[model samples]
Target: MEKLIKIISNRAVLIVLLILIQLGVLFAIVFRFQNYFVYFYTFYLLISSAVIIKIINSRSNPAYKIAWIIPIMLIPIFGTVIYLVFGRVRFSNKEKMKMAMVQERERMANESTVAKTTIDDGNPNAIIQSNYLSKHGEASLFEHTTSEYYPLGEEAFKAMIEDLEKAEKYIFMEYFIVHEGEMWDTILEIMVRKAKEGVDVRFIYDDFGCLFTLPHGYDKKLRDQGIKCCVFNQFIPVLSPIFNNRNHRKITVIDGKVAYTGGINLADEYINRIERFGHWKDNSIKVEGEAAWGFSLLFLSMWDFVNSTESNIEEFIPEYAPGELPENDGYYQPYVDSPFDRETVGMNVYLNLINRATEYVYFTTPYLVIDNLLMEALCNAAKGGVDVRIITPHIPDKWYVHAVTKSNYAQLIEAGVKIYEYTPGFIHSKTCVVDGLYATVGTVNLDYRSLFLHFECGVWMYKTNGVDAVLQDHMEIEKLSQQISLEQAKNVSFPKKVVRACLSVFAPLL
Candidate 1:
């Protein structure tokens, strides 16, 4: 009965009702109001035609142009409407300019003498030299910063808590998901205490990411505790189509001296206390130095976006004197990517590292959704004899996404690319280690959402000694992962194959 009622109230039902109303009006006009009916019909036709043309012309991605063109030509109105709503690229120029201004200021600050003097001479191997970083206006090296890698969630949590406790000046945190669990409670306690002590503690969490995890008015609760809180893109129950755009970046900067970022969110699942899938394995990086200030600025920008609060940049700069580097060793450049920009900097950076890799390319991501450009680049690298290995999860999070992930296996596997799935639990780390010379760790997943729709940030390290630690962690994960063979992919069930094919159509949405 409920379903029947729902059917009667659908758009199709509304359209039928509209048609009946038009017929009634026409009859009335023919008998008593002929002039009004003709004008109405003419106006409706003109508006409908204009909408149809607008929709047809909006079908844009170059890859899908041909496929959508025929449909658009056939069902000019309906097809065009769908295309206009879902197709083409859209960005706000105003937001882009705002972001550009912030980034430019950051660049100028990075080039200052004070920024140079802050480099730690003791650590000379901390810099990465890459065309992608240089082209994007990122620093070629980061000085006065040190980094620590946490391979497991428990370790990362402990380290993060310690860092928070040691924070003297301020604390800035941005996370996608913050659940009501022991993990968050512990952090919240510390945050409240820190705020009470007059520490400028601020936090930004994505509304959609925590919609189900947190209850209503959670942000208010945090603010009442003295912790400045901002919920990114507050989720509205209705008329909120943009909920898909999330602040997927996980960053925490303390006193502009230390920072943490990686795949781990503030949830029990990440720490293995309340496992949802299986043993959850993740990774995080803790950094201390001038580079950490960059992350602080990144968090501040997002915080201001949500809270409308302006921050003094000078206050956040670490106190250090300017001088020549004691050694030409450690330089660190950190940058972030936003969907508001036309450039897919994170994706392009990954591609650049893969292409320029001389020895090996090791990557870990939960999803394997690839666009054509990335697929070709990886395959070409494999064909060029660069060892390419990727680690994905064995315990599927979203089955359909996993199926889509498997569907692309054959092409890569045949090209001599090695793929593995962690057998014990889900591997949520989004990291890449190339040629043992450069590494990246952050929240940018290897999928359409992270590649194009969401805001992301990652630490790109080149010639950094930290690459060895990342490589070691990757090796440890490989030991626990099972490698997939072409034979296994070929034997996938027919029905499952069809499901994958259908899901692939909406891969962009995923």
Candidate 2:
């Protein structure tokens, strides 16, 4: 009875029930007005045609277009309605205008403090990448920056707490998840103390992502503690296309001098305090020096978007006196991606790394659902004598996602790409290391939702300590992971194969 009540009161369950009720009402109205069926069919046909044209014209992945078209061809009336309601990317005009305003504000901020990007003439490939990000992603590279990699969430959490305690100017945290547990409780104590000390402590968390973990009035509670908090893109009771674009980036900036970003979130499970998935494995990186300014800008941009207030971005810019800066070692370029922007910075960065690799490419991600572009890129790199390797989860947090991930194994294995599953448990780390010289670490995942739909961010490193650390961690994790032989991939059982095939067709939608 207790389990039944829990299910009845669950937010996800309630949302599904509401959607079903709406669908039922629509069907009833259609049936009751049967005599006007001819007019309704004509309207449906016109809408379907218009939708088909729009999908073709829009600059979306070819696979996504086919996925939507298949169902539309099968059931025109319902499909057309669903496509307009969900498939259309340009759903919110207000959101588009707001994002434009935010970008303009950022541009003005950058103009105030013009930091010239210095290129390492020795590493031509790295120079190419930095230029690409600067041109398309609107991010500049920094030469005087250093980084430290944490192979586990606990390690990152320790470093994060240390940095939080040292914040004398401001502390900005933007994350997708924040559960009220041992991890957050400890952090909250620090943040509240910092806020009371006259430090500007602000936080941004996604509404739908934390719907189950946080209480409804949690933002108010945080504000009561003198911490400025806002929920990003608040979830509505009715269905809408805006929900597709989630704030998936995890970032924390302290005093505009140090920053952090990666798969780790503010929750106990992330640090393995309370194990839900067996031995939760993850990674994070701490960046110090000039590049930290980029992350600070990223956080402020989102904060402005949600609060409708333009901030003086220059106020937070780091002023590193002589000898206060970290050693000028390697190149560091921190960049952000958004669904609001037509460019796919995260995906392009991954693709560029894969294409430029001469020796090897290694990556670790929680989910492996990818499109043809990424699949082909990995396969081609492997086929061209590059050692392409990927590590996914053995004990999955989502069974359906695991099934879809497995569906693509055969093609990759056949192309000489090595696929491995972390044997101990789920690997939630989002990292990519190529040729031991280039790398990226952040919240971006190797899946359709992350690549093309969600708002994400990462740091592209060249010959930095971060690159070497990423390669070292990849090697260490590879030992604990079990490789999937090509024969094993080919020998999937018939029933499971059928289920996977069906799931793969809709994987993009998932």
Judged by lDDT, which candidate is best? 2
Candidate 1 per-residue lDDT over residues 1-510, each given as its tens digit: 999997676544544576466555644544453357677556545655665455456532333344444445565344443444344445466656666666665566556523343334343333223445644634334655567889988899999999999978899999999998899999999999999998999888997788667776788999999988888877653322364578899999988878899899999999999978898989899877667877876777676556545566777776645652123334556767776665677787788788778789999999998788888899899999999999999997898889889998988999989999999978999999987777899888888888877888888876565678899999999999999999986788889888888777667766
Quantify all predictions' global Cα lDDT against the true fold: 0.76, 0.88
Estimate TM-scores for all models. 0.83, 0.96
Over 4 Å off, model 2: 1-13
Q: CA lDDT of 390 in candidate 2?
A: 98
Best-matching candidate per TM-score = 2
* lDDT (Cα) of model 2: 0.88
| Residue 476 lDDT, candidate 2, scale 0-100 | 92
Backbone clash tally (model 1): 12
lDDT by residue (tens digit), candidate 2, 200-234: 99999998899888877689999999999999988
